[model samples]
Target chain A: MNLVFDPAWLPRLGQGVLLTVQLTLYCMGLGAVLGAVLGLVRVYGGGRWSPLYWVASAYIHFFRGTPLLVQLLGIYLGLPTAGILVGPFLAGLLAMTLNTAAYQAEYFRGAIQSVKSGQMMAARALGMSRAQAIGHVIMPQALRLIIPPWSNELIYMLKYSSIVSMTALRPETMDLFGVARSIAARNFRYFEVYILVALFYLAMVLILTVALRWVERRVRIPGLGTPGRGI
Target chain B: MALLRVENLHKRYGHEEVLKGVTLAQDAGETKVVIGPSGTGKSTLLRCINRLTEPDQGRVWLEDTEITSRRTDINRVRAKIGFVFQDFNLFTHLTSLDNVRLGLMKVRGMPRAAATGRAMAELERVGLAAKANAYPAQLSGGQQQRVSIARALAMDPKLILFDEPTSALDPELIGEVLSVMIQLARDGMTMIVVTHEMGFARSVADEIVFMEGGVIVEQGTPDKMFRSPEVPRTGEFLRKISDLYGESR
Candidate 1:
């Protein structure tokens, strides 16, 4: 058997890699904001039976329960029937953002809960309002606790961005996987192309893991949220 | 008028009544020590004074304001009344300096430089000035408690509430925390301390209030309470505590 590698595929793959990075960044940035809000609402929005808590709970359950591909296709194909037209790229981004946010919200909620309740009492005792306490005392500590799970979300989003390439989107929106598929289709070098694309993902995930661990170490509150360390 | 007053405070958790119509008062510059056997509502009484724990019934007054009134701003009230927990409850993520300075900056709205200066002064008062940069976990339990006290003191509250402040500290470390509290007492800060440290009660408390079964069983000068409590149960409980904790130095 003969194997062929094409130099032209490199630039195309680079463009895909760039798109993937852009999509992941947008999803994560927006997801974090939305997730934190949802998480807060779920935890502090009155009680388990309150309307706000119910809505947040339902939203989280709906997104987390459904298949990601179904969500992607629903947003892509279903919106048009309701007089809302979304481009494939927008649909994919929206689906991924909402999906990642639901997962991240749970991570954030758990982190917030993991912080000792005494911290909130102490903050309030210092005259901080509830919002102020959450922003200053609780979030600083909660954000630190979320780092481990959040890193997993980040890496998952990176790989998950590949799901976009499987859809019929504009050529410019093609991510690493799409670029590899097209290259393999034309050259009939599926094995070599997939192997190379897999390596790219491995490298990106490795880099993300290292960066996140560094952040986790730097911001860690010694005994807080660390496994087996009683706070 | 007393600097602090609690009238018929009642609190219940489900079927259990934690505080049953407890009334007390403290003048300015007085140190009132609350001593009791475990689970006798001592901690709940302190918590109610600051409105940290809501009372099922009754009222609290700090100077002129009714703290239990619905119209009162609890946050503002809390800012003026400091609370030190048994576990220190120092903001674990913050350095000792930040813990002390947080309220000064955030609640008091003091400038960073002013807050820093004030915080340092409080830390110095507690003899933890050298450890200001340390996080709560980095400090010994005694040092963390001192930092918590400094954190409260930086606010310059009208009164401070100590809920077993040294209960979580090791025996050897309890003295450091008590010394700080003793100094606060001598310096004439209004305080309510819930503790088993009979020694601290004897040396610093203007009045020692003994609580049992959710009410004040007896209250009088520390000397009177120790030497001759009106209620026989008060004397019995005191003797038992003294035997167990050994007077807390």
Candidate 2:
């Protein structure tokens, strides 16, 4: 087996990596907002006609239960069949956002429920409207609780973006995995190209994990410093 | 006219009746202390006053307004009846000052600056002015309870309901909170307190009502109720609680 090291390939890897990061950020931002709204509806929107909760639950079940690659394919290929044509970037964004919202919704629901019932009662006793109590009192504490799950979602979204490579036909928009596949085909050195791509992903994940862990530390409630850790 | 009146109040959880046709009334600026066994519906009665827990059947009147009849605009009545919880249910996310200021601003439509000023005064009254900027989590249980008092007092309500204000406190810390309540009572505040502190009831309450099995078993002036009780249940309860506190000490 012959291994050829190409120094110029670093620049291409960097560009592909940047595109992946951008896609992850966009997906996470949109997904988090949608998931939070849905989560709130599930918890507080009384009565049986909670459309947001039902739609959100179905979306989460469908996306989380299915493979990301299949979801990417369905959105990119299956949508065009229904006369709804979308570009590769838009399709990738849509798929990732939908997938992320499902997982993030569970995170938000858990966080919101963790807040003590006394907090809401206190707000109401203070003459705050139900909406004001949720917005002013419950959500602030819920936001702190949601941070850990959101950080996990961020990393998951980053890894999941790789599945978009299957449908992302445009060269400029192709992510690291797709770029690696094309390079492997040209050089006939599948092992070398794949290994480099794997190394890049490992490095990205390592950096992100450390950054998020630090953020978790900073945002954690003072007395509640990391569950199971001794005072 | 009575400042507050509760008629035929009945609350049931499943088959268990918590408050069984209990009724009471209070004059303006009157202080009433409700004493009862653990599950005799003293807390439930206080909760029903603010609609924190809805009663199965009841009519609660605040002055002329039928609070229980018009359920849609109960916030108006609620604004005039401040409630304090045993657990000092201060919003952990907000500072002590913010907790007090929220009702004034949201319910009374006070300007932010004016609300802050009034909140500061209330905190000062409760001896928590120095800790106004601190979160509930940062404050001790006593301080948190004081902040809860401040939060209720800031609204300048016609009545304040306290549900075991010192029940969830340390022995030494109970004095400070009770002291604040004594001062509020002296200032002619119409307050209903559900408390185990018979000492506080004896000191500050104009009337003491003893509840048992969801009914007011005995009610009279503290001097008559405690020193020379008319009801056997009241004497028994007092003896048991006094023995428990004595043993704890």
lDDT of 2 by residue, B111-191 (tens): 999999999999999998999888787888999999999988888789999999998999999889989999999999999
**DockQ leader:** 1
Candidate-wise lDDT, in order = 0.91, 0.86
Error of 2 at A137 (Å): 1.0
- Please give, as one word, the docking class of candidate 2: medium
Query: Chain A TM-score of each model, in the order shown?
Result: 0.94, 0.91
lDDT comparing candidate 2 with the true structure: 0.86
Please, what is the TM-score per model?
Answer: 0.97, 0.93
Query: Which parts of model 2 are misplaced by more than 4 Å?
Result: A1-3, A47-53, A222-224, B246-249
Model 2 over residues A1-231: C-alpha lDDT tens digits?
A: 678879878787788898888898999999989888877877875635777667767777888899877887898999999999988778899989988888887888899899999999988887778988888888888988888788878888888788878876667888888787777787788898888998988888889889888876776654444567784
DockQ for each model: 0.74, 0.54
RMSD of each: 1.8, 2.4
